[model samples]
Target chain A: MSHGDTIPLHPSSQSDIDEIENLINASVHQSVPSARPPSPPRASIPVSVSAPSPSPFVPSNLPKSSSSAVPPPPPPPTGFGPAPNTLTEPVWDTVKRDLSRIVSNLKLVVFPNPYREDPGKALRDWDLWGPFFFIVFLGLTLSWSASVKKSEVFAVAFALLAAGAVILTLNVLLLGGHIIFFQSLSLLGYCLFPLDVGALICMLKDNVIVKVVVVCVTLAWSSWAAYPFMSSAVNPRRKALALYPVFLMYVSVGFLIIAID
Target chain B: MDPNQPEVENYANPKTCFFHVLFKASALAFYILSALFIDNFVIIFVVTVLLAALDFWVVKNVSGRILVGLRWWNEINDLGESVWKFECLDHESLARMNKKDSWLFWWTLYITAVAWIVLAIFSLIRLQADYLLVVGVCLTLSIANIVGFTKCKKDAKKQIQQFASQTIASRFSSTLQSAFSVV
Candidate 1:
């Protein structure tokens, strides 16, 4: 149909158009003449129907046989067919086919890389390596600081252990059990050998206000570390898992710092 | 929504608030620690104030500006790909604008990196180890910021390219479908 003629049909009564469409669909199916002969007969009907209509609904420039020239027949006053049900199986089947094909192709295209499908492994790597690296560096720093000042070596070592524990705990909360446990164990040597770092530091420092401040600071940092995982970018379950290690790390650091100071 | 529009306000993410509170608390704790351990009150006060100011600037300004730059980059890149479909600006003009903006972003990153390195080195030289440790923690917080900006840039580039690729692919498929139906 000509685009101009189709414009007028849009505002026509919805039920009337639907009834007309149903009638046309039924007629087409009922009178399914052999494909070779039916085309010309179907093409001729519009030419005969449009000859008398001079209304605005008809486009003058359309080919004489095209449907654009014919005014659609008025629909019956009452509803003719069953109310439209929820989408039928055939409609859903087509949608499912399209979606499955798209998803399959996308998966194939996106998942060829080594890390693409193994996010858990990636999280484990980050959790383990991040704390491992941080602890080793912290140990070296503490060793050097201890060498310079003999009395504070135990205190520094304890602080590092607490930092490691807190980091491990937060990673667990963020990454989940597998990563958290791996990270915590990997860093456990530091925490255990550091001379009861949290308690030692708490004994050395006598002030209550400093201990309270340290606790508050640690809580705040833990909350910060956990915040990004809570974003829409990360999966909810993963975010929850990641926060555990963050919480542990924060508390551990707070306690150790409070003890040392 | 037009991603091209400049970010008028900092879209405060949960991370932003968390970092703000963390940094503020860290700063306060460090100041108190320094007051207790180190005898130089004036120097500690000045450094603490400066750190606080820096943290505030980061929490307020950095992420939003980076996001704005990223959005502009994507819109310009998209415009370049669909230059023929748009009538207002020709391809050459759009390409020039894209080049200019992209360079601006790179320059900003370069400057920020240089400043961070210099500050880190200076802190190591001048500040006490405890004070430097607090700075280290603050600096490490930028790991998140860097990751976020990198991800934004990467995603923006991917999205723009994907949109162009999808449009071309859909058009090709539609044409093939019509041609096959005719046959």
Candidate 2:
């Protein structure tokens, strides 16, 4: 029977025609045509009936049998993107690891690399919590020793954070540094490490000489620590300019802690 | 892949997110209120320590892993030496990590650490030996979380280096073999 005549007789849907064509194509391509003769319905159908319009039966988009045998599945996704590890671990495990890293950072064995492209990785290594907490504790201790009120202590802390944010923002906007805001904050926060120690020492020692020595040492430490980071973050020509804000930031934090009454 | 557990994407669901923030914030708020409003220092110390421990647990297991896909644990080997194990989200997964969850994790982590250290220093100045004990525990817990993730970062670096080296080595060996066969 002609293909068009069979379409009305068997009620074969377009999908069925497509599947039959695929089977015939597969058999022909596999060199096993006699194994399953192309269904009479498909062979008799004209290319036009199954080609353009889907009128209950037909298939289009034929593959070149010689080369396109079994089209490959769609390529798997590519590129290394930021993806969280799929590890579902208990919390205690993470705590232990964090403790070890805290000690390592405190020993100054590893510094957070502000140059890291991944903000998360750089911030993670910086252990901002350890240094930030230590600095806050020391800052509060200094304020308390000086008999500063709690409200004043809050004011100073907020002012320091706000100032650091402003300086870092300015660096990003004007200097064109690609520093992530939080990562920059983390780096600047660590710059206070020396001042924290200085505060602690000045608190313990009543001698004017010791306090002065500690202040000088801390100023140098904070400046030196910040110089490398700030320089690398900004344009080479603008390194010196970038360092100015960091220098100012550190000095202000120290001044806030010491000058508060 | 249990139907019950949250899908990878849903791990950062609003409910978990809410609980995560609530637990950590409430722990600190409760401790501060107890320390400030409560008259009995003994009660204050006990409550604060307990609350801090609770926060430590919550941050470590819940927010730490779910929010950032990082976790760690301490184990003692046969020799009684302590060994640390860290797990972190793969980079591909990290790429899909929720930004808000990360923001909450890092900020809260930094603030929590600072709070504990401040309390610890306060106790030291006041010469309150009992309060120091609590401070010590809280500090240790906080440090553990930070240290675990730092080491995880290091491990990831090491793994990448190793994989690169292996690939290069295999390519070199294959090249040598092919050249020899050609000869």
Candidate 3:
């Protein structure tokens, strides 16, 4: 008979429909009942035997009927299992679920960019090189402020020379034989002997006074060294390291002041 | 959420403000006392250093405690929310998870309170007599802060439980609807 022409079963003759409805009603009744009476001993035996029969019957459909059939062949173990396209749909669904979860949990607010990890780059961006150089020059000019008494001038000159030497040493150590070495050395000479010939400036300077001069000069030099660290590009670790010299100068001054007192 | 973002609106806890004010008052007292009565430079310097050391300790301790408190508060808040979410997702699991989180929150809060009380007593003993008035003010403020925090904690707990129950009901309804649709 054609599919549409099939006769509908009468209620009296529909044993399958009756069985299904009875089964469903029994399930609903069992679910509603809180206390379930224990099954009779013989009734449990059939249930226990039937439970595993379906699973065993599924494997029996395979061709092998011998003892060797106990070891099932691995699914295409020699070849690449599946293409990306085959798994993509399920993976995409999982990703979509996770993304949706993240979206729901996240606050939809945007904030300004936070502080940079490096600060030295900021200093560089501001072009503070001129100020740094001016500070060095200012330190040298301080000597000119002193009265031209033979001893006072000598002390000032000595201090300037000491400062210059310290700067030169730092530049050399930090830059390591770069072309800037000669330029720094020349700047050092100009700082130490501004008006007079270089040899005579050094010959008459007292060693004790020169040491004091060196301390002041070293302080100025270290301050200049720290200027580059003010840049936003400078990493905190490097900035911290660069700050050590300035700290050392402060400590040294503290000791000197204490000794003098 | 970006993990780097700082979650708390204020880094300094209200409780910390009290300690800071006390420390500052003590510092001012120390300075005035040294200037008026203690003329010896060495003695003044030593006293200053000692006071500074004590101040540092107070700030460090208070800051540490506040940070711990803030972290725990956040955890509890988050846990409360999570419990609610879990309940909505699966009511069968809610009882177990809720009990675990409640126990954890209570334990952390209790331990923190005990630690704070110990620290408070220690601070009271260590602080100078001239600045005892400031310390008393700090203690009063701290007590107020504790009371406020307790109220907030209790409210949060109740709100979270209610939120979870509501969520579960809604989710359960939706699940039933979908099951009915398929059937």
Quick one: ranking by DockQ, best first? 2, 1, 3
| lDDT at position A27, candidate 2 | 34
Please give the lDDT score for candidate 3: 0.32
- lDDT of candidate 3 over A4-31, digit per residue (tens): 3323222334443333334333443443
Q: Which portions of model 3 show Cα errors greater than 4 Å?
A: A1-208, A231-261, B1-36, B40-63, B66-68, B71-183
The numbered model that scores best in TM-score is: 2
* Predicted model with the maximum DockQ: 2
How many backbone collisions does model 1 have?
Answer: 24
For candidate 2 chain B, the 10 contiguous residues with the lowest summed lDDT are B1-10
Question: Which scores better on TM-score, 1 or 2?
Answer: 2
Q: List where candidate 2 sits over 4 angstroms from the true fold.
A: A1-86, A106-124, A162-166, A256-261, B1-22, B28-183
Give candidate 1 regions above 4 Å deviation: A1-162, A165-167, A170-176, A179-261, B1-109, B123-128
- The C-alpha lDDT values of all candidates are 0.37, 0.52, 0.32
